[model samples]
Target: MSFAEPSRIEPDDNQSRGIALAILLLPLTLPLFLFLCLFVFLPVGLFAFLFSFTGELLFYLSMWNDGRTLTRRRLRRRLAAGETGTLIIEYPMLAQGRTHAWWTPDDISTLAPLPIPDRSSDEYQDAVLDLMEQDQSHPWDAWCWQEYTSTSQGKASLLRVWNGKKYQEWLARHYPSIPIVETTSEIVRQLEIEAQQKSHQPQP
Candidate 1:
């Protein structure tokens, strides 16, 4: 089955705040290291030199001006391969300087059955909801989709998002009876099986 086309939301300029911070800190490392080397122990000097170079490189890599495009391309490939579902949410942690794993649909589970109240359509609400809203039944409010943790074994976790309203609407308009699951891991797993089977099939 084909998956919904993934759209990469461009991080707003405000999101560049992290990059700005990284850039500002990048230049200060040398002077700080020199000062430390001059006033501190020799071991401190060696460690300072090594850590300063590594830190600057990490900052540049994580906050490069082109990093956003790299992220978007990776996401597009995953989407095209039917690798994401409604429950998948990309977590970008700029403060920590890392992109968390893309959460998959199958990873979501319900803590209990509870209705997700409609937060939209309210008169006084903001133009956008920054984080995802979940059905109260979801076990965890935020889960790393697609990534399975040792603690998550056997136990189901909750998956929630905008509830795939747009994707469902598009599918309904195109193929009214299409069966789209909340997550994509099962589909991808099945696809892998099918591919292996086809590869092993005898040639006519």
Candidate 2:
């Protein structure tokens, strides 16, 4: 299926979120300032305010740079009919480095939708609660779909669809032949099996 126009993929502004966070935390310095004014000398109070402001600014700037690095996007060419090349899919995470997988046109088996799990599912609810407890932020809104591919070498993840609902819908419409699965775990299991097989292979 042909890809939508390049303009359709809205580029994320990486700095905006960091700036908002910094602004939200800026008020926290006021308490430190007050504390200093009540017990410390005037010169010491002024120094503390400057030090706190500078530290806060630096912390946010560091976060902004890291966010920019993780969310950076590059222009990708649309796949044409009979085209054969490597298609790379990236998974960006906040606590860990980004990971990627690749597949060629021949290796792809099907494209599947990855729906958000129902809130009633205990596993899903627990995962959400765990994230909340950790107080960590995430870059992804939702995992929209996945591309499953296989070869004699074994199965591999061809692509991970994120923030691409429209693109996924267009693909589903144009490529009616590809079977769409509902969950990601099945494909993940296939990948794990592949990894096990590869690990067991004798040294060349």
Candidate 3:
């Protein structure tokens, strides 16, 4: 929950003439700035209006499935608290977000890819800005995950990143406990082998 001393991320307001602006101006600017992700699941949220429990259940289930050995919220939260685990993920992409895999701690279990949108796009920038404007805030990864949950991602993922130098530096400084590796064909191959081995084991 604690952040680095700087906690440098601040909400951006390119239009900060006065507070009165939001009362009237936000509606005017909103349509121009709204991104695809915001409205993409508009109906889903409407559906939740009828059965909110179903939406909450799906979101939590998504979190648990993506957790270590299939439980908890996220791997990085543990790493943030100084827990050690080799956190494997798709090779960091310049634009698109990356899928994640965290297995038996120093030991691993599942391997799969989750689809995500490009982080470097204008749509993403606007989406993040809109989320921040609403005071929907969390640490970077958690914030992104919150956005991801709104859509069909919950149906596919237990789980699901940024640029190279900036992204790597951020991860290293923020989470030093885990060895975060980009996936290579060889690494993916090994995980596949492990999955096959586990599949043959007697079920508890």
Candidate 4:
């Protein structure tokens, strides 16, 4: 029997960081050129005027380009790392069709609001710290999807090892009737065992 699909594993319809950074810096060069012409040189000749404009433009352009290049490099590093775990999701209160969503999951090295132990054992605290640090290392992987009413905070998803029972419960409660596909090793084995049991049914 086919199990339900995991609710969170859906295709993203958004621009990646590389594209966003490139677009952001594309027009910055123009202003740089204009500034250089105005302040750097006050000459009357055509060549001086042209040079000033070009220099200013190039200056701004260079800054913009540098910023974009840095952004792209960072984005590439994150993407190539196959970094996993955690996303802080934000969506609108109400949408006409679909909500406009944006998240900085890739660069997130730490997610706030995690449960912190108070005066606990050093060992336990250390472990918690490790988990939190790991969570930050790949914020994009961990996710919490919430849907709010016109007012009030929406329900938060339960922390489930991906495709585990907790995730299934979250789907059943929040999404309702949504299929929960178990992709985790433990859950998959449980499923396989159940399947084999059903298959071995004494002739119906």
Measured over all alpha carbons after superposition, the RMSD of each candidate to the real structure, in angstroms, is: 24.4, 22.6, 20.5, 31.4
Q: How do the residues 121-144 of candidate 3 rate in per-residue lDDT, one tens digit apiece? A: 576456645655664422333322
Q: Pick the candidate with the highest lDDT.
A: 3
Q: Compose the digit string of candidate 2's lDDT tens values, residues 49-100.
A: 7875665456335434443211212213333343343333332222222233
Model 2, C-alpha of 119: deviation from truth (Å)? 10
Enumerate clash totals for all models, in the order shown.
8, 0, 4, 14
User: Candidate 2: deviation at residue 13, Å?
Assistant: 60
TM-score of 4: 0.16
User: What TM-score does candidate 2 reach?
Assistant: 0.22
lDDT of 1 by residue, 1-204 (tens): 999999999987876998898888988988888877787877787897778566545533543333321243543465567653432222222122222222233413342233322222342122123222321111222222213311122122222121224444554565453333322222233334566789999999
List residue ranges in candidate 1 displaced over 4 A: 1-33, 37-78, 81-97, 103-204
Arrange candidates, best lDDT first: 3, 2, 1, 4
TM value for model 3: 0.25
User: What lDDT is obtained when candidate 3 is compared to the true structure?
Assistant: 0.42
Whole-model Cα lDDT of every candidate shown, in order:
0.38, 0.40, 0.42, 0.35
Please identify model 3 stretches exceeding 4 Å from their true place. Answer: 1-82, 91-98, 101-104, 107-170, 184-204
Clashing pairs in 1: 103-145, 104-145, 104-146, 105-183, 108-157, 109-157, 109-158, 111-137
The TM-score values for the models, in the order shown, are 0.22, 0.22, 0.25, 0.16
TM-score of 1: 0.22
